[model samples]
Target: MDKYRDRSNTLAKERLTRETDKQASQNMAQWLEEFEATKDRVSEIKRVKSRDEDRYYELLDELEITPEYDRYEIIKGYKRDVDALTKEWLKATTPAQRDSCVQAIIGLKSDMVRELMNTQQ
Candidate 1:
């Protein structure tokens, strides 16, 4: 009777493992299907982002914005600091980092130059 019970337990364990693995496989398949379905939307968003970036860059090019023209040493220092921050922002993945960097470089809700030279010690 004990030997029979042990065999039954082993079979039960094997069956449970198989069922868990099967469920996991099904979940992965569903996830892949969902990802495939969103491909078009993802592509559209990426294209829009590319266009927007290109336009922003073109504006910068037309404006010829640079730090080299600033005559004051303090303003040049601010430009350098802002430039470094903007470079970090270009590589940032999170929205918060991007927003903060942009705000630091460009004044909030205004195209006018911000006073950052005084902040630097």
Candidate 2:
């Protein structure tokens, strides 16, 4: 009798767990749908602005562009570093030193290009 009771209890718990998971999944889907609708509504707004508000939004737009400008600066810095490395590689008196500089330049350029591509996306 106790063995039968234990089996039944386990079955009941499993069923309850499955139902809870299903309900939670449904709730999450509904929440995501509502969130997307809210985002769409926000994007559709077209309001006229006063000069001060326009200036404020312009500053905000500039703030958004800041990362792109920073990335440009980073790329420029990488180019400068790579150029310096190239000159060093050229002027190296020893083959070993030249090889080392070549490796450094290759690694730096690869990293810089990867970063540039990733940021553009």
Candidate 3:
């Protein structure tokens, strides 16, 4: 009777484990589908943004407009974001906080064009 009871308990434990795994698998599958869809949309947006930025710069070149820069030759603009992110990065004390600051900086850099500066001082 003891051996039979132990066997039944084992079987019940396996059944519960399988059920939990099945639910987790279902959730993961749904999340994967959403992730792929979002990834594709992001790629599309990047392509369009690239095309538009190129067109805008080309027009500026054709119109004989020269873009000016500051002391370091970096473009000057009203960047509330740079201030916010600088504060966040300075105040970040955890790995997760630092990682978020890194991500934000990378995202901000993506939209900027690298400017060539004259070094014939």
Return the TM-score for each candidate structure: 0.29, 0.42, 0.32
Model 2 residue 29 lDDT score: 34
| lDDT (tens digit, per residue) of candidate 2 on 39-119 | 443333323234366755665466446545445555557757766766675567898997787667657755755565566
lDDT, ranked from best to worst? 2, 3, 1
> What C-alpha lDDT does candidate 3 achieve relative to the native structure?
0.46
In the order shown, what is each candidate's alpha-carbon RMSD? 23.3, 23.4, 20.4
**Candidate 2 wrong stretches, greater than 4 Å:** 1-71
Query: Clash number for model 3?
Result: 0
Q: Write model 1 residue lDDT over 1-60, tens digit each, in one string.
A: 989977875674455334432443434234334434444434454566566977655544
Question: What root-mean-square deviation over C-alphas does model 1 reach?
Answer: 23.3
**Per-prediction count of colliding residue pairs?**
0, 0, 0
Candidate 2, residue 4: lDDT: 92
Give the distance in Å from residue 42's predicted Cα in candidate 1 to where it truly belongs: 50
Which regions of candidate 1 fall more than 4 Å away from where they truly are?
1-70, 107-121
lDDT of 2 at 94: 100
Q: Say which candidate scores most in lDDT.
A: 2
Collision count of model 2: 0
Worst 10 residues of 3 by lDDT: 69-78
